[model samples]
Each structure stands twice: as structure tokens, then as C-alpha cells.
Target: MQKMKMIKRGAASVAIALLLLPMADTAHATIVKHYGVDWSKFQGNNGKWGYARDDFSISQIGGYYNGYFIDQSTYGTQVSNTIALNRRAHTYIYAQFSGRNQADQMLDYYLPKVQTPKGSIVMLDVESGNPDTDSVLYALKRVKDAGYTAVLYGYRSFLTSHLDLASIAKQYPLALAEYKDYKVTAEPDYNYFPSFDNVQLFQFTSTYVAGGLDGDVDFTGITENGYKGGNAQAPTTSTPATTTGKQLHQDTHNYTVKSGDTLSAIASRYGMTVNALVTLNGIKNANLIYPGQVLRVADSGQGSTVSQKATTTTTTSTYTIRYGDTLSGIASRYGTSISALASLNGISNPNWIYPGQLLKLSGGSSARTYTVRSGDTLSGIASRLGTSWTALKAKNGLANANLIYPGQTLYY
Candidate 1:
């Protein structure tokens, strides 16, 4: 985790005003929140999820996180991994899809193939090159009509520059991705929060290295079954009845350790004492905590269940600095912090960085099979794999290196 400086971008002023408007009261507590990841083709099975599993209470797996169908052969394998992760970790899992040609195809071609359970989210990943606003809206309508929770994922720039986010923000919850300089900033730029008034999730860092995953700040439990919007509707099965004064229990909520977070700070957030937290989670050394460590913040009654998710051992990778790179420039480019880089590389001074110095980029890469999908290119795969285009082509034995298709297995 890295501290992010919040700088207001152009449209933030108006969005703040919109946020000030009064609305119906909902349950407001630190418990109804979590942090998690959005996966894609580059990542493999849950074992390869690396340090990420330690930091997140929820995960949004993409057969649709990007707009492509996974290779059919491995598609079932991915779904099985998702379910196993959810059950073993007691984590909330949602399904996300990018919108373009695949938006309309989600309810048909994709959903059946993945078999995401009902009541789980089906989010729209809106980024550059997505379809027209009307087309995207219609596609969302189809998702909502299919009995899944519909949500929107886009950055402030993507929404402001590419589409009319205002039109749909009122209709659905917005997951905003807006990154600032994580090395120096302590928190996300509240000033630059998007103008779409219904912001639900804020992705503060794409390069969150604490858990070796993307960092997000979520207000609503989109993964925790707390985002179910009700209407003039019948009572659904197994829905827990709303109870006032339910005992504050560990199973009820959790908090991920963020950059600059201390045990005292987290205890303060949950209205608990430091000793209480330490006792609850069995912390032998309060000062030895690191980023991405999940802390149990609440106490449970006799029936309260405990999570079984354990942190797995992780590996590391190295990246040699290029001539033009500064510590800040490298940190920004790699989604890590200058401090983390310095700590990993054992540099005494953050300012002193040079070419040919190998900095640890992430946890070690695992050998895996990637099934190519529509719109994938060799160059794109190489960038994600941390290898060059020529290396990838040679590894896959491509004569042209320019052409590839869906369902082709390229080993890395």
C-alpha cells in the first residue's frame, strides 16, 4: 500500500456539490466495506493470486473484467478456482465484464459459460474504446434484467473524456479508478472524486504492491452481499433479516491494512481499543505489522464464524532501471512506491537511483498457460508478462508475431 496525494482534477468541484445533496439514509458503518482485486488474462489460478489473497475481503473475477471470453478449455477451470477461493477464504466474489462487443454478449455467451451465481455482481468495465453511451446503457439493462446486480467500473478520465457518466451514475453505483502519486500522497484525492454522484468504490492504486495487487477503497460491500438494492419485491431466500443491535462480531466485518495504517489507527476507525484488537486477532507483536495484512476488527458471539483464509508464501521479481528513470517515475510506471522500491532494493536514499539497478517489481511470476481471446495482441501480452514482444513471439514460435487468435495457448 502507498499513500496517494489527492489533487482535484477539473470536474471534482461539481461532483462534490452533487454529493452534498441529501438522500435516503442507509446503514453507515466501517464494517460495511472491503478492498479487493479485478482480475484478467494475465493472472492465473488462485495459487498464483500471490500476496493478493492476504489483503482482500472481496474479489471481482473477470471473464468479463476485460471484454473477452476466456479460452473455453480453461474457462471452467477459472470458475472452479473462483468458487474454491470464495469458499476457502470466505470472500465475496463478483463477476465483471468490459463493454464493447462483449457487453451484449455477457448475459448469453459469457454468463452461462462462467455460471456466476445469482445475487453476485455483474459489473461493466468502462474504459477507452468501449461502445457508445447508449449501447453501453442498453447492455447494462440486459445485465440488470438477467437478475444480477449491475454496477459500473470506469476511471474519472474515462468517464469524463469518453462517455456520459452522469447519465448512468444515477442508475447504478460507480466504481471509480483514479490514481495519484502513491509515493508521497497519504490518501486518495478527495478533490478529484468523479462527478458521478453515486460513487461506491474508489480504486486508488493500480500498482498496489502491498498485497501485490490493485488497491481499492470500497464504501459499500459489493462483494459482501450488502449491495442488494430492494424495491417492491418479494423476500428472497436465505436473506438475513435486518436486525438492529446485532452483536458486533468478527464475521460481520474486516479491514485491510493500508499504507500508513497502524494498529491504533485501525482500532480508532472501528471504535475499538488497541489491546482489544490485539487480543481478538492474537497479535504477538503489534509493531511488526506490514501492509496487506488483514486485521480482525470486531468480536463475535457464540455463533459467529471465523475466516479460514491464510496468507501464502510469495516469490519476487526484478526489473533493471533504464537510463531515463527516476525513483518517482519508476514507481508511478510500475504501480509501486519509491519507499517500497528502496526497501526492496535496499537503497539508502530514495533520490539516488540509476540505470541498470534492478528493482523488485512484484512477486515472482508463475509459469502458466494464457488462452488468447478476441482483441489480444502479442505486444499487449508481452507488456503484461513483463517480457518484450520479441521474446514473447520467439517463445511462442510466431513467424509474423503480429497475428494471434482466441483460444490459442501461449506459454509463459
Candidate 2:
């Protein structure tokens, strides 16, 4: 059972648009305010998907009920159709939580069948069964382990009664279902929002258009976050922008931690060592990171060495978009911004990238050299350069790879 019917509540006297307010900080900047819909087998494979103006879509994959795995027959068709229309597609599991094992079984059965990209969001629809806090948390962790952004979806009453919502909100984003009435087409009134932070999506109506379809509004861009499609190829070169008479240094960027994230994994993803991350962030314990904790991934300061060559030519490279490609994922993999890619490629819609489309990547300076630091290791340097220690040794002609000292110059 999905989106259980509830008695209609009285409409609010004043409709306050809370999400339209300015975000408190830069961490909330990625939130994409777009309308979407959640579909299930009941919706069928009809051509009337009111998706002409929608930006994202979520479809139910399956569930575990009565010790049996129930699959949603329309799951594959709906997901593929949504993607085919150039919409951001995601999947949800209608979890009937009997215990931790049942939760795992539900995910194990349905995760293999998910049709979305690797880092797309996967929601756990928890409206039925007796859901304990541990079982729900375990299921969310399982979803994250499978490489999808895990979101918890439920009505306000069900979530508050069965789980510690405050604790859960700290670790995972929430998709709350609270409607004024059935078949209502208006936007969600923020006055009736649940008493919790990290509420990324609000399910406002059951019947979005002529036919019955659950309509949702994403206040935060949780659906837009993460890699969307295609295999992300590594950039060929590491290019550092230069200024006259000034030495180039590694610029820092912020990464907000998500549920089930470990320091090692974050470090590995950013091509930095654990020790470097710890030193950069002043983290006392590497294993104590929580969701929403913003960590700086690189160093920031003036370098002691001055650049001999101040002028460099701009180099351009091309990437062929594969199946399920997205501008966001391509930009991220190439260390460029979506806006930059769109501007470079003259792409009007970032979500409408197609297979075999060629995208131009423009950046980088001349050949660069790295001066080893006191605490630097050979492998650590190679990771930062997107190369291996063996390559670094070969390029620099070092007899003893382990005997590099401080102030040693290495070319990558």
C-alpha cells in the first residue's frame, strides 16, 4: 500500500511560501525548485503522464509483504518512459518493515532492478507495517551502500509516532506527505510543514492532473544532486589557473556529507588522502563525520614559489555523452560547473543531454610542476594529480620512489 488515504485537514487561512525565503547559507544553494510526480503500478503505462512541465519523476520499484517480494509490474516501463522524456528519474521502495532482515530482503530484491543512474535518489516509502527506528535506519543505510542517495518518505503522523524524526532528519533528507485535501492542485503551504529540518520534498496532492498522480515539490535539490548517467571519464589533465607573478595553489571546495558517508570514502572520491583531509578540516577523529557536515577538500593559501611562466594558452577537450548522460554529472567529472559546460556547448537545457552528443571542455594551463612538502607522500601526490605513483616516478626519473625529500620538484 502506497500513499495511504487520510482524512482531509482544514486549509490554512494564510499560505506562506517558506521555501521562497533566502537560504541561510551556501549549503542550500543546490536546491532545485521543481514540480514532480511519484508513480506506481496503479498508474499503469498509459501515455497520459502529466509530465510535460515536470522536472523530475519517482516510480515505485517493489516491496516486501508477508514474507514475499512483490514487484511493481509497471516500474521498468514508467522509469524508462520518464527518462526517455528527458526528465530526472528516481525509484522508491514501498517498505513493509517486519524486521531488519525483511528490510534488507526488500532492498536486495528491488535494488538490482532499479533503472535510474548510480547516484540518483532512492526513497523508502514507509506508510505501512510496524516500522521501528532501527529497521528504518538500517534500510536507509542499505540504500546508501548501494550508491544511491537515500531518502525517507512518510506522512507526518506516521513518522513522528514510530521514529525519532529529529535524529533521522540529521542523517537523511525527508519527503513528507501532508496534503490539504485530495485532488488539490495548489502548491504546498509551508505553514503545515512537519516540525523537522532537511525536508527536501513535499507531497502536496494525490491527483496532480486529470488522472490521479501524486504531485510533489522539491524545496531542496535532493533529486538534482549526485551523478545522473553514463560512465564519468577522468579528465586528461590537471589545469591550474594562473595569475601574474603568483604561484598557483590548490583551491578548496566544500562537500556536504550525506547518510552512510565515511571519511575514507569522501577522501577517496576527492582524490585526497585521509591525513590530508584531516589536516585540512582539523578533524580530530576520521570516523566521527555525520551527515550535513561540510568538509573542505583542498588547501588554500599563498604559495612560496613564484611561477616563472605567467602566460599560458587555453586548451579544449571534447567528451561524447553516453546513454543516460546528464550535464551535471559530466561537469562534475570534468571539474567544471554546469553553467560553464552549458555555455561552452550552447546547451539551453542542462537536463536534456542526449547519447553520443559531443561536449566541449575548456580549461587548464601549461605543463605544471609540484614541489613536495614535508608531510607529503608519493602516492598521495599522485592521487591529487589523478595519476599513480609509478607514473610519477617514471615521469620524474626518481631512482628511489620512497626517498623523496621536502622541496623536491616532481612533474605530473
Candidate 3:
């Protein structure tokens, strides 16, 4: 927004002012995040992996991956008849269905002929095989009636006590599982599975690029609609029990541990990494597993959780800072603390808060100011605007978290 003019002629005065701003762009994307071996037998003969189309290249590095389903045991003696043929990553397959005729030969003989390409996404790194719960909801309704889109990958208490990725993402698409220095977006939404209304991806770096078949290949981000980008709609009022509600599409499977259970209550029901369900079940202590054991789950997602959206009438308020909000990370949201919010809205050096300042957040929600355009920052706008940089510096009152500049404005 831009407009400013003031004049004084013969008699006296005239003024015109209207400046509303926020837009800074810079971030192009094309990710690739695959994990080691089990690439349906990945093996560049030696560059290391298991077997895709050989001579490695994986689209020369830009497509992106996040798999790691080691030993989906070939579903039927062996698989992977085609893969990486022309290099294009968007995968997230991770298998393990066991019985119900191997989940009906992976939903009617190998998911409607595996040929991926056309906004691709297929899932079920189900942190445990052995059907029950109606053969994993009929193999996720046969990969969503063979059109595609279904993810339940586990880790974090075995994906919330069995499975409920926002109620199976309201019917498929919830992929979240990573290793090392952890981060399925720092879990906590009942262990993990907050909303993008069914979360699409967040495998986060698994390692082992270049293709094979489709075993270890999660790494993905490419978002336009769904993914861990979070906060899409919903939130109009209360949401900070750390957020995680809404998603009950028929109470997602209701089983309680039997047959001896406990790879830690099946990896905490469903948040998983009993060593990736003991490497998709071939086993080696997740404390020697137990019960009817059964396990499998994967997510090596690399990147892709895009966002720009925010305006249903934008609602999470508590703001008041006007005088042209200092152009950097702006001010502390509403609860106050950009140095007590520029000293309770007065203005000093906490980057001199401006733009009609005033914040308040005990319960009267109203703190909206999101300007930082031109390809925003604060860690890719807290990974594409879902949010996080200590909650955008405690809602924007940064004393210095790596200070910011170039036209700023923030408030969650």
C-alpha cells in the first residue's frame, strides 16, 4: 500500500496518506530427499542405494525425496518394474500391509499399476503390518480408490496410539516421520499430526538420493494445497493447547494392545521410530519388540510445505502499533514484550515500534500485522508461513533473534 501527500497553499493545509504494506518475494523450489538403501534394491552398482534405473542422476538433483520402507519385502517376491525412468520425485510410498491377501495385492494388484506422475503421492508406511482394523481401512480404501493420496507413516508413539492422523487426514494424506535431531515440525499435537486438514508431507531429510524402486524415498515439499504448512483455515478462535483437534472421520481404528503389544505401545500408538518399525520389520530391538509385534512406517520428507494464504477474515488478533511499524521483524504480538512492546506502546529502541502500536493477548484475540513480503524470511517465513521462529519472535518483539530489516511487520 502506498500514498502520501501534504500541501499548504495560500490559506493553509491539505493531506493525503494511506500506506499499508507487506510483500517481499524470494524462494523458488524443487526438492529431493531420499534415504539410504531399500530403494526397491537401490544400487548404482556402487554409488550406493538399491536399484532404480541405474547410472544414477535422479533428475540431476532437484526433484526431491523422503522414503525408507526397507523390506516391504517385495509385496510379492519382488517389485519395482519401473522407477526413476525419467527422474521426477514427489514420492512417499513406504509399505507394510501383511494379509488380506497382502492388502489385496497392494490394493488390487499393485496400486492401479504403479506409474507415478500426475501430481503424484501414494502412502502407507503403516508402522505395522498384520491386518485388523478392517485391513487398515481396506488398504486405505485401496489407495483412495486407486486415484492416489494416502499417508499414515508412523513414529512418535506409533502414530498416536495406532492411527488418527487428524482422523486419517480426514481420509488419507498425513505423512510425518523423520530421524535424528528430530522434527516432524517439533511434534506435539497429541504427539504429531496437526492440521493442514490432513497434513500432506513432512518426512524431513532421510538421505540416499538417486532412485531405485520406491522403498526409501519420502523427501517432498512441493505444496500448493495440502501439507505440514499448517494453519490453513480453522483457528478462528482458540488454538493453543499446542493445537491438534478436528479429525474424527469415524474414529480411526479402536484397538488396544493385545498379543503382547509394546514396541513401546507400538511406538506410542502412532508417532513412530521403533527404528522405523524395526526397519519395516526384520527386527533388532526397539527393545526386542513384543505382542503380535507387526510393524512398518516411513517418512524421509525433505522439503515442501508452502503457504501464502491467510485471510478468511484473518483471525487471531490483539494488535495496536501504528506510526509506520519499524520495517524489520516489527513488534511483539499483543501479549507485550518487544521490550514490553516498545514500553507498552510508547517507543524506544526495541526497534522503535510504530504503526499505531497497542497489543493485548490474555483472551481478547486481535493482533494482526503480517508484512514482510518480497519472498519473506524468518526461516522461509517459518517454513512457508505456517509459522515458527520462536513463533515469529514471540509474535514480533524481537530484541535480536538475528534481527531483521527491509520493511517489517508481524503479529500472530
Q: How badly does each model clash, as a count of residue pairs?
A: 10, 1, 92
TM-score of structure candidate 2: 0.51
Per-residue lDDT for 339-381 in model 1, tens only? 7778878889887877788788655744344556557788887
- Model 3 quality (TM-score): 0.19
lDDT of candidate 1 at residue 118, scale 0 to 100: 51
Candidate 1 segments whose C-alpha is farther than 4 A from its true place: 1-24, 27-31, 47-102, 182-192, 210-212, 226-412
Writing each residue's lDDT as its tens digit, candidate 3 over 1-412 gives 0111212222221111100122112132323233322233233211233344221111110111122223333221111111212122222344555445666655554454343332234456566543244566677777666554545555534666654445555555555544433322211121222223433344433432332221232223322112122222222222211011111101122122223244543433344434334433456555554333233422211011122443222333455544323322232323234454445445556544445555532344344555454445577667666778887765554544454432344555
Cα lDDT over the full model 3: 0.37
Candidate 1 overall lDDT versus native: 0.50
Q: lDDT tens digits, residues 1-412, model 2?
A: 0111111334343223234544545544433477888888887752235556686778888877747877887776565455435566678988878678888778778887776766777899988878888888888988989878899999979888988877777788889887666664746655555545677778887877765778888766666644323211111111110010011114555555544456765565555556556655768988798756777754332122323322233334888876534565455344455788899889898878777898888545333467677677899889987899998766654445675544444566
Cα-based lDDT for every prediction: 0.50, 0.64, 0.37
Report the number of the highest-lDDT candidate: 2
TM-scores for every predicted model: 0.42, 0.51, 0.19
lDDT comparison, 1 vs 2, better candidate? 2
In terms of TM-score, the best-performing candidate is: 2
> Any idea how many clashes model 1 has?
10
| Residue 90 shift from truth in candidate 3, angstroms | 4.1
RMSD of every candidate to native, in Å, equals: 25.6, 20.6, 26.9
